[model samples]
Target: MTDLQIRATAAPAAPGTTARPGLLLLLVLTGQFMALLDVSIVNVAVPTIRTDLHASGAALQLVIAGYTIAYAVLLISGARLGARFGYSRLFQYGLVGFTAASLACGLAPNTGSLIGFRLLQGVGAALMVPQVMSLIQRTYTGAARARALGLYSAVIAGGMAIGQVLGGLLVSADLFGAGWRPVFLVNVPIGLALLAFSRRLLPVLPGDSSRRFDLVGLVVLAVALGLLVVPLVLGHELGWPVWAWVALAGSAAMFGLFGVVERRIAARGGQPLIPGRVLRAPGLVPAAGAIFLIMAGFAGFMFAFALHQQAGLGHSALRAGLLSGPVAVGFGLSSLHWQRLPQRLHLPLPMLALAVVAPAYLVFGVILRGGAEIGFGAEAVLTTAGLAAGCAYSPLFARALSRVDPADAADGSGVVVTVIQVGQVVGVALLGTVFLGEVSFPAPARTSGHALLVTSAAIALAFAAAAAFALRTRRAAG
Candidate 1:
């Protein structure tokens, strides 16, 4: 065997009884939901946060982007850490940190403190989120694994929509007159409960002593991602500053350096953070590309639409959040049920669904351009788009990971999850720019309508590109 082979043995389950798959899944998935939910939940509460903390635009942007960037930059390292330490051990550590960060965010006295806490929250999520997928990949096999992935995908898609809805509710409810703090504080109790149950439910696995940490790879990758993501996120907000441009330009070179360093590590018979074999797995690259494109479009749509509803249409926070209900329901239903279809249809489904998504966005744009409120027509269109998105997204995770070797599960999960977080950051940065540039705060309805239409066109183009990649994925798989 090559020295690069990935191998590890899992210790027995907790003291008395074996971990029940269903309960175990619930425990881990809830952690996944919280981690992912924090990404978008803050969107609905941003205005309130701005008012409450007297935050500047840059600070506000950091509050949202910092978490995602930190989460993305450290994912591969976190996965490697999970393998070096135990998955269960890292998960508990991450949960404790995330929950404590949540409390600090809720109580933060200023924008600076909030941004710092948010970064810590992202770090916690980075450590926790990868373990969820690694756990799923390591624990289950056959149909059970498939079902677990389906639920996992549902949580993945549902979290963004649910965050908006739940955030709006929490903020609007103004529980105990705490205003925007509830959104962060709500995680406190749930995190504590999950930590309690996790001790008993998760399997205690042994660390892989054979594998060594690639500190150079981790630092290079983190710097590369920071250069890429920071500029993409902060560039427009800073009016395309020279540093942003320079950072964007430098990121390409840094990524090239990262590749060279990884290859050197691999050539020396060391395990690089991201194994070359994982990236070369058949169908994995195209599937990841499709995932990145679709997620970018989906996240962009959510961010842009939230702005349109509140800033453009003058909707209440609750109503704006409630507007996303159809999407959440549709995504949840489609993601959970896609596997029921016949075997032959599975490979082509993503391409077909993505094709549907492109036109769905255009149609949704047309409806809004007509100056219609989010009536039944708009709701139907949104739900259809959500259903298509679910169909496109759920299967791709399985498709990409299926091509990966079982031993590379943690590395593969890290790569895919990192792609997802980066996609969201890019989507918000680019598409949000399109929306913001076209419409300003408290603008005329007509202006807002036009801005949304333009933004939707951009989103449709992204989905169209995703469809092309999905087609490639189908061909590659076939």
Candidate 2:
């Protein structure tokens, strides 16, 4: 065995350690929940923040998109950092940074300060979020790992759901007459509590110190991702300017350059940000494609649906949030219980779940096209989509990493996490643009209906494409 492997084997829980596995799981998952909650929590507060700060439209967009942009760009590097330092150590550092940044965001005096603090928040999230998956991969085994992943999936869905609900609630309540500040400030107490418990509960797993940080690869990949994601995030809001199109074109070239650099690094017998061996793992590609598709479809649906209700139909933020509860309920239910299905059906289940998702979206599109109100049929369709999404999310995640060696866990985690963030950006940018373009500010109910119909069709197409990837994943697994 290599010297690094020797140290890794010795780095797990010491013989006399008292950390309970269950508490440790809770500790790490809570950290994940906090990271994800921040992403969506700010959405409902954007209007409030703009009004309170007298911010410009561009600044408001930055406040909304800055966190995501930084998080997407830095995630892989953060994963590599975990592999260089210890996972537990990096998680702690990230948590401290994230908590502090959240406080700064809540207390910002103006839009510029808030934007800077939001980017810092993303930096902390990039450092912290990737480690959640790496820790789960390294610490758990077999069925326990599967269950942990199930809970992780649930937290993901739950975080998105709760962020909307809680943000609306906090803003509406205006507690202490604080309109939008509580949304960011809420994390402070939760983060502080998690910090106090993390060091004691998390296992001290050592990373491979021999693997050098690939500085050149990091720079190339960061630029590539920045070019790709920033435009996708801000393009629609900025009315698809020439700079956005140019950035999109530039991203493709940068990605090509990044691939060349990774190959050269491998040729020289040095570590790349993502190892070539990990990229070649069976099932990883198809699983990743499916994951991208699933998230894209779901995120687009969520984005367009929110606008359809609030901007198009003149619904209140709180009511819109409540209306979307069925999706979260369905997702949380299926994600936690998918394991109980017959063992013989396991391999084909993700594809079947995705099959269900495609039709549900198609039906939803039809309903929206018909100018259907937010009634029983519409809610049912949303729930069905959520259930199928929940089913596909966990299994595809497992399939993607199942063949990855423990030594490559951080690399694998980084890739998956980055794909998710990118997928959400693409979904919102593409479908959101379509929706927004079809309607005007103060859009009539009829105009909103047409816009939603078009967005739903696009989202349905995305799900259909995802189902195809899921099929390929099934074949890959077989």
Candidate 3:
């Protein structure tokens, strides 16, 4: 470890010592902002990337999906890895790697190389993110911890909103004649600044060296996820070849294998990545289904919306990005209102939010069919939907945790995180196919209309799953 890492890992300067929680929160939120920004930022630049790199349909999807794939697959393992390596060391390493990856992505000569570097970027994010909550848990207690967590959630939603605007602005400016490259190049300086000041700005706690990891489980899960994601993203474009069918079959088999391996590991008193028993828990499957449906709609909307503005409506990148500002405003303001709500409503809000948001999506689709132009009318609907979107996620997460068996809480949360990622991956892949193949981009309004309708149907399914989970939970309580 470097001197800074050593300093971060060492005991505090004084007993009962507390570093400045305010600064510490800033440090954690910054890391989170960078991670979240990258996910949505690329959406606005997707068209530019395709044209500049002469990317194929599959490569374009890969450019987007690869990062999420790596991040989702490795998140739980990253947490366990931090336990062995120490959060401070892992965090520092992740920051450096992420910075380097950003530079690589900005400088990438082709789509293949960009895809490869994006995956590396995701690896760094996986390492950096799991430590945020761990650090907050280490530094703050009780009400302070709760506030910090709320701030963290707000950062996620806000970052996503900002990412769209930023990407649009960056690409529109064509900075240094670099076009969309700055969308990624922008991360380099921020990553470096974080590296320089992280030791000073962040607080760290001791490591638990006794934690054991399941490498076999990690490998099995990775293969399983790849099997599911790859074919879905590439299948229709390739005419649904025999290989796609093989991959889908392989995905099913790999999932079964993952369960068997995890079960055997737990049977032998080993630390399995996922606990087999949690799979059988009451209401857990429905909860996962609900969360997956919610995220799928969320991810699909981002991918399709950006493309519709740029390719269909002929909006300049900056205008598209600027249009997204209201989404952030709506989400940020609504999130504050959400936080003030009674704690009892937290678990049910996701279902309720999705129920309303579904119609809002349909409403937007109806308006777009008239004209997909980014006018006062469309922007207004986006802001309203943003308010509903803000309510959807936190509550679903709360519900998932509340439904889990106490003994399986840790693994249950871990599974929820993975499922959320998987849902996003599927969303981008499945709906991306629709956006590329079905929608008539030349007809701007029709294109936008079709895409939003797709998202509406997806959200409706999520609402259904949420309704099922709600009924199941009420019956159990009764």
Candidate 4:
């Protein structure tokens, strides 16, 4: 190991370190909570942003897609960068960047500027998020690690719920007459507070001084994803021009080139951006497929539901946020039981849960069609969907990483996260477009809600097919 690696690996804990781990975990979790919360918190604010910026529907889509694309593309590079420059240093820098970017986003006077700022904010988030898992792995061991993972998982689920609630409150509060700007600005105080705490709380991890930056791999991957995703997101809105198809075709060729380059790098004894062996793992294919399908369904539902509740139901942002709470609660409740289910069941619990979740969405579709008023009944169905999603997600992730070597953990995580992010883009593009097209012919007031319901049903059917395939593959392998 190089001197930096030695320093990173051999960094000493503070004297009598009992309280420090707990304190560090808390600080880390706080930052992570903010990062995860921002993902969905903005959903409820989409309409507000649209109106405020005088944005087209396509512009609004770019606001969300821009962040996710940047986030996904940067994740692997961020991990490698942290390993070279030091995790603590990168994390602190990321925190500052994220806070600054949030401010920029809040203060952006136009749609274009807002989208640019959001992309920058995503880069900061990508830098910070990978460190959370890496730090956990490095800091905690054995039962402590397990407990930390459990806590981390719980916090993640809780944060998703809190985002909606907080988004609602912030948008409705219109603090300082900033309107939706407060939603972005809210991160500043929390981020600054975390920065203060991190100085004392985070243990310095050693860096690999000899680690060479994979500039070629990074450029190739970024270009490939950008070519692929940017077009998908923009193409539908632009009426699918021939250039979109050309871009899509170019993306496939870029991906192929990326693979070949990575292989060459690995053969030459360098660390490639992504290790091909990890991707070739036996169970990874199905796991990835399942992840893609599940996230596609989930993202599409959220996008459509946000529009339905606000535009269709004539509800305020706060009411839309409140209506979404049951989904969060359901996810939390189901997640708590994840560890216990596999112990009692002979089958892969994730596959089983996914199987159940498809039906839950179908039932939700029925509920929507039945015209149940938005009260307890709507809440119950949403909660049920959340529970089913929670149960399905935890196990799917566990299965994906079950056989991965520790050395490749970060890479594996990055790959899965990137795939999910891409899935989200596709989901919004395809499902959202379908819904929009369907509703175009309908009367103004009645269209959005009905379109949303149909989109939900479509997603449910896709999830069912995916779940069935996963279960069958597992059985065949056995």
TM-score for each of the candidates: 0.94, 0.91, 0.89, 0.91
Which residue pairs in model 2 clash with each other? none
Number of clashes recorded per candidate: 0, 0, 0, 1
lDDT of 2 by residue, 1-478 (tens): 2111222342333322334878888988999888887777776676678679997655765676678778877888899998788888889989999999999999999999999999999899899988887787677654555566678767865676566667777777788998899999998999999999986887878767986999999899889877876777677677789999899899999999999999999999998988988888777888889888877777667767776777667676677777778887787787777767786777778878877888787777677764557889988988898888888876777677666666676788688878877777677666766877787657677778888888877887787787777777664445
lDDT values for all models: 0.83, 0.77, 0.73, 0.74
Question: What lDDT is reached at residue 63 by model 1?
Answer: 85
TM-score of 1: 0.94
Name model 2 segments beyond 4 Å from true.
1-18, 54-61, 237-239, 369-372
> How would you encode candidate 4's per-residue C-alpha lDDT over 167-255 as one tens digit per residue?
88889888988989988898999899999888887877867788777889999999998898877777767889999999999999999
Ranking by lDDT: 1, 2, 4, 3
Lowest lDDT block of 10, candidate 2: 1-10
Clashing pairs in 4: 8-206
For model 2, what is the error of residue 49's alpha carbon versus the real structure, in angstroms, after optimal superposition?
A: 3.1
RMSD for all candidates, in order, please.
4.0, 4.2, 5.8, 4.9
Candidate 4 at residue 45, lDDT? 89
Please provide, for model 1 over 1-478, each residue's C-alpha lDDT reduced to its tens digit, 9 standing for 90 to 100: 1001111122112222235988999999999999999998988887789789998666776788788988988888889999899888898989998999999999999999999999999999999988887787667665566666778878987887789899889988999999999999999999999999998899877777777899999899889888987777677667899999899889999999999999999999998989999999877898899999988888888888887887778787788899988887888788878767776777788988888889898889888974458889888999999998888887776667666777787898799989999898888777887888787676887788888899899999999998887777664445
Return the candidate ranking by TM-score, descending: 1, 2, 4, 3
- After TM-score superposition, what is the CA distance of residue 449 in candidate 2 from its true location, in Å? 2.3
